[model samples]
Target: MQHDQPRPRRANKSGIRQVLFNSLSFLLIFLPIVLSGFLICRRYGNVQWVFIWLFICSAVFYGAWEPRYIFLLISSILFNYFVAIQLARSKSKPLLAFGIVVNLGSLAYFKYLNFILQTWSSVLGADFQPVAITLPLGISFITFIQIAFLVDVFRNSSDDLGFPKYALFVAYFPHLIAGPIIHHKEVMSQFTNARLAAISANDVVGGIALILCGLFKKVIIADTMASYSTPAFHLAGQLQPISFFDAWGALLAFTFQIYFDFSGYSDIAIGLSRLFGVRLPVNFDSPYKATSIIDFWRRWHITLSRFLRDYLYVPLGGNRHGVLRRYSNLMIVMLLGGLWHGASWMFVIWGGLHGTYLIINHAFHFLKRKIGEQSLSVLIASRLFSLLVFPAVMLSWVFFRSESWQGAKTMLRGMLGYNGILLPERYQAVLGSLNDWVMSTLHMHTGDLVTFGSFRAVLWMILVTAFVFLLPNSQQLLSEFDRSSGLAEDGHLRSRMLAFRPTAISAVVAAGVGIVVLAAIYAGVPSEFIYFQF
Candidate 1:
C-alpha cells in the first residue's frame, strides 16, 4: 500500500551507471584495504583479496536488490516520523494507541513470525507452514528503534521528529547490518540540527581505530578458532571416549571465538557510527572478567540489556511486583530474548538456563538482605562464588552453539565422562595418535595425532582466553588516561590535534593497508558476517 503511493519520480539510469557509481563510492572509502589486498595477491598469489571483494560486492547487491526495498525502508522512516509529529501535536489517546500497535505489530510480524511458525509446527505437528518470507535486511533492529521512538512520542518524552533526521536514523548504513541498536531519543536531536560539514578529527580517528580492532578480532581470532571448532563439534558424535581435555579445549575455543566475533562486529558498528558523528553505546566490556553471571550480563551486550529492562522487564512488573512475580517476569523476558536470537529449541533452553541463573541470584540477594548479613566479606565471597557459577553458564553455550540436538547430547555425554565404548575401527588410528600426543604433551602417554590437533587448538584457545579476561575494558582505559591528563572536551582542539597526529595517522594508514591485504588474500571466499543468519 505504501509502495502504491504516487511519488516524485527520479530520472532512470542504466544499470551499469548505477553499479559503477556505487562501486566507485565503496572502493574509494575502502581503497586502503582494497589496494593492500591487490598488492599482496600479486606478490604471493594468495586469493584472500578476491574473497573480500566478492563479499563486499555481495553486500552491495543485497542493499541494491529490488530497489523497491529501499522504498520500504524509506516508508518505515516516514511512518515513524509522521507518527511522532502527530503525537507531539495532539494528546489524543486513540492516536497514541494506534501508533503503539502499528509500530510494534509490524516489528513482530516481520521479525518473529517465522520463528513462531517453526516453533509451533515442531510442537503441534500442524500443517501450518507459512509462505516463505524473506526478512528485509536490518528489519529487526530498525523496527525496534522505531517502536522506541513511538513510545517516547506517546510519553511526551520527545517532540515531533523531522523527516530527514528520522530517515538518517533508520537508514544509517554502518549500524544497518547488525547493530548497537540506536534509540530515537538518543539520535534524533543530534541529526536534526547537525552541521553536515562539522567533521571532528577525533571522531574520525577513534572510528578508524575501533573498526581496525574489530576487523583484527574477526579475521585473525574468531575465524581461526572457528576453523577447528566447527570440525570438532561436527564430529562430536563420532568422537567416542572423547578425551576430556580435547572436548574442553574445543568448547573453550568456540566460547572465545564467538565472544570476539560478536564483540568485534559491535565495535566496528560503533566506530562506523562515530565516523558519521554519532556516538553509539558500548556493547561489551570484558564480560569474561565478570565474577558472576549477573555481572557478566551487565558487561555483555549492554544496550540489549537496557532494551530488555526498559521495554520488557519494567512493563512486565519488574521488581515492583512481589518476588515471585519478579522472578516470573525475568524468566519470561529471558525466554523471549532467547527466542529472539533464533527459532531453535536450543536457544529456548539457553534462555531458560540463564533465567534460572538470574532467579537463583535474586533469591540469594534477597536472603542476604533479609538476614541483614551485609558484611563486606560476605559480599566479596558472594561475588567470588558467582565466578564459580559462571562456568556452568558457559557450558550451556555448548547447546546454544551445537548444530543438532544429537550433537549437543554427545558433547554433554563426553563432558560427563562418557568414554565411547563402541567407536568405529576406522577412527582407531586417528584416535590412538591423538591420545598419545595428548599424553606426551601432558607427560601422560602417547596416543593419537588426531588428538594432537585438538591439543594445539586448545593451546591457542588458552592464549586467547587469557587475553580476553586480562585486557582492560575500553571504558576503563579511557577513564585512566583521562585522569592522568584531562578529559578530552567534546569537539575540543586538543582532541582533534591528538587524532590527526603523525603516529595516529600512520597507524590508520597501516590498518587500511592491512585490511586491503587480508581482503585480497581471501578474495575467492564469500564469507558473510556470521550474525546475518540471525
Candidate 2:
C-alpha cells in the first residue's frame, strides 16, 4: 500500500483545471465547451464526426492530469479491442489468455510491482532495488473494465465490435477516473443509438439536478465527516492508544465517510453520463440500512459486486457444489475483493472479516428458516441483531482505514477498551456521586482519566448517524423522476420539503445549495474522490 499522507491533503494533481466532475472548471468551462461542440457536430448531420470528436474530448479530459498516462490508456484500449476481434474470429483460448495476461500484466507493473519487490526483499533479507513506477490514474478501474469485456468476448457474449465506440467506452470521462465499472454490454448498445447524438432539454435539467445533489453529498456531508475521521484514523496509524469512545467515534466517522465519498462520486458519474444522454449503472443504494452482510454487498458498490459474482464467484463452483464450497467461494471472492482495493495485508484481513460475517449471516438465515414463525420477542431480537451488524462492519473498517496492521491493532485495542473508558476530568465532577458509585460497583478505579475526543466531534457523529438512519438516500429521493413529466407520482417526498424535479422554485433551491457547496469548496481545497486510489 502507498504511504498515508497527512489529513486534508491536496487530492488533485497540480494543474489549472482537471477533469473532476464536481469542480467549477469542469461544470462551468469544460463541460459547456465539449457539449456545445458535440451538439453542433450533431446539428450538422455528421454522426461519424460526433463519435470522433467525443473520443478526442474524452481523451483531452483524461489527459488533462498527465499527458504521458494517456498513452497507457490508449494502448490498453487498442490492444484489447484488437485482441477481442481476434478471439471472435479464431475462437482461440490461448489468444484470450494472452489478452488477459497483457491487461493484468500492465496493471501489476504499474500498480503492484513495487509492492511485490518490497515484500520479496523483506522475505529474502536483501535489498532489492525497486524501479521508479508512477501509478497512472484509474489503472485498476480501466483494467478491470477491459478484462470484463475480454472475458465476455471469449465467452462469445460480445458480438458487437467497433474501434471508435470501444475507445470512447474506455475513455469516457464520466466514469473514467472512478467508476461504476461500466460493462461492455451495458454501454456498447447505448453508443450505437443515433438519438444520443442530439442533446435534449430534459436531459440537461435532470443532469444538472443530479450533479448538484452529488455536490451536496460530497462537499456538504462527506468532506465534513473527513474532518473528524482523518485525525482519529491518523492517531491510530501512529499506533497511539485511543479511548473506547474515541475509537467508536473514529470508526463511525469513517463508516459514513466512505459511504458518502464513493457513493457521492458514483452520483456525479451517473449524472454526468445523463448530461450526455447516457445512463450509467447505479452503484449504491443505502447500504447502511441493509439487514445482513449478504444484503450489504448487494447494495454497496453494486457494479463491483456484480463483476465479482459473475466473473470470480460463479466461475469458482459458486453454491453449485455444497454449503462448504459456497462458503469457501465467498471467502475467495471477498479476499480478492479486499486485495483489489490496495496491496495491503490489512485489506485482506478486512475482506476476511466480511467473509466471516457473510458466513454467519447465511447460517443465521438457515436457522431462522428452521425455527419458523416466532413471537414479538424473537422479531425484536432479529431487529437488534441487524442493528448490531453495523458495529461489526465498523470493526472490519478499522483494517480498511488504517495505514498498516499495527495501526489497525492499536485502534482495535482501543475499541475493546484496553484503553480506559475515561470521562473528561472537567465532566467528572458533574457526574458527582453517581460517577464514583458506578465506578466502584464496576470494580474500576477512576483517576484523572483522559477524555476520548472533543464534545463537538461526538456531536457531529451523532448528527451524522441520525441523518444516515432518518433521511432518504439520493436514489430514493429521485426515484422514478422523469424530466419531461416534471416529477413522477411514485417519486413521493418522504423526508424533505424541497422538490427533486426541475422547476422555477426547485431550480432556485438547487442553485442556492450549489452556491453554498461551491463556496465551501473554494474556501478550502477540493478533495479527491477516495475510490480513485483503487
Candidate 3:
C-alpha cells in the first residue's frame, strides 16, 4: 500500500545563537572574546564582576535567536530560584509542588500544547485551530536542571550558593543549551575564589584538543553519515518500500550519526566549560560497545541516565518494592525518557521498545542467576549477547528515525524482506554470471541481493564499527594528559594508547585537526546538532 515518498528537509538552524560551537565564527570570534573577557575580569576586577560579566555574555549568546525568549529564561530562573529559597527557608512541600508544576507547565505550554491539540482533533474528528508556538531553545534541559536544584533544596542536600552563582549555573551557555545536564553539588562547589581567579595551561591545552576532536566528529563523521541516513528514512516517510540491504545500511548509518552528533555536542560543551576553568561531567563512553541494554544506558548520554535514574526511577520505588514494581518503574522511566526527547508518538514507541528490551534483558539475567555460569564462560557469552543486542538497538532506531507509525512499519517490513529485493542495476550483469547451480542451491540469485548504491555506506559502517569497537573515545584519549580534571578513565585496552601530552607532536596533531575542522565547516553546509531538537 506504500510507495516511495520525499523526505522533509530539515531546517538548517544551528542554535539559538548564530554561532555554533562547531562553526568557525565561534572559534575565530565569539569564543576568543568570551575567553578574553573572563581572563581580563579575573585579573582586573572582583570575582562578582567576573560572574556578572559572564552572565551578561551568556545572556547575549542566548538572546541571539530571539531577544524576547531571553526574558522567559530569566523569569524561569528567578522564579525557580525564589521558590528554592522559600523551600530552603520553610521546608514547605506546597512550595516545592508549586515550583514543579510551574516548571513542567511552562515546558508543556511551549513544547507539547500544539501536539496535544492535534492529537485530540484527530481522535475526535473535530476541526481544531492550533496556535503557533515556537519552543524556547534549551527549555527542556534548563527545566530539568532547575528541578534537580529544587529537589536538592527540598532535601537540604545542596549548599546555599547565592543568586549570582546559581544564575551562572543555570545560564552558563556552555552546558546551557544542549547539556551533559550538570549537577548542583559538583558545579556550584567549583565556582570558588580560587577557580574564578585561575586558568591553567593544562585546561587550555586539553580543552582546545577536545573542541577540535568534537568539531571533527560533528563536521566530518556525523554530517557525512546524515547524507545517507536522511534519504533512507525519507523513503519510509514517502511510503516507499526499501530493500533489506538499504534498510539496514540506513539504520546503521543513523545509529552512528546520532551517537557522534550528540556525543560531539557533549564533548564541545565540556571542552568550552574547561576553557572557563570549570569541568563538566563526561557524557558518552562508547555506548555502542555495550553488550546489554543496561550497559548501553550507563554509557550513552550518561548524565541523562543519571538524571532519570536519580529523579524518576528512584522516586518510582526502584527495585526495593518487588519485581513487578521494578519492571513497571523501568517502563515508566523509559517511556518518559522517550517523551522527554520529543512530542511524538514515534518517540513513545521507541521508548516502549527499549522498555521491552530491558525487561527481556533482566529476565535473562534472572535465569542466569538461577543457572550460574563460570566467569570466563559468562564473559564469552556476554560478547555474543552484545552482538544480538546491537541489532535490537538498530531495530528500535527504525521507530526513532521514522516520522510516523506507517513509515516505521514500511521500514520494518523492508528490513524483514517483506518487500521484494533487487540488486543495483550496475551489479546485474556480474551477478547474472554466477553459476546457475550455485544460485539455485543457495536459493538466492545475485540479483536478489542489493548493493547499497555505492560501497561508500558500507565503508562508513566498517570505519565507524572499527572506531566503536577498536579505538579509544575522546575522554579516554585525554585521560592521561589531564589529571586535574575528572575525565573518565575506564581501563579498556584501546583506551590506553592515546594519553594526551603537551608535546610538539601533540600540538601539531591538534593544530592539524583544528585546521581541517575549520576548513570543513567553511566548505560544508552548516547543520544543527541533532540533540538541539530534543
Winning candidate number (TM-score):
3
Candidates 1 and 3, the one with greater TM-score: 3
User: What is the C-alpha local distance difference test score of candidate 3?
Assistant: 0.78
Q: Residue-wise lDDT of candidate 3 within 369-426, one digit each (tens)?
A: 7667556666677678778888888888887778888989888887887775555545
Model 3 steric clash pairs = 3-239, 3-240, 4-240, 5-238
Cα lDDT listed for each candidate = 0.60, 0.76, 0.78
lDDT of 2 by residue, 1-534 (tens): 333211223455544236566677777788899888877876774656667888899888877777888898888888999999888788888887898899889978877786678778778877767677766777788999998898898888874777888888888888887788988777657664466655577677767777888888877788777776777677877878877766777777778888888878888888788777887888887788888788899888899999999989998999999999999999999998987887667777888998999888887777777776385655776788789877888788888888877888888898888976656655566678787886666444444322234666667767878877777766656654552322223333563453366568887888899899888777765474567646
Q: How well does candidate 3 match the true structure, expressed as C-alpha RMSD?
A: 3.3
C-alpha displacement of 329 in model 2, angstroms?
A: 1.1
TM-score of each: 0.75, 0.90, 0.92
lDDT of 1 by residue, 106-175 (tens): 7567666765676667678766656566556666677677777777777777633655446656666556
Look at candidate 2 and tell me the lDDT of residue 454: 60
Ranking by lDDT: 3, 2, 1
In model 3, what is the error at residue 462, expressed in angstroms?
1.5
Error of 3 at 493 (Å): 5.8
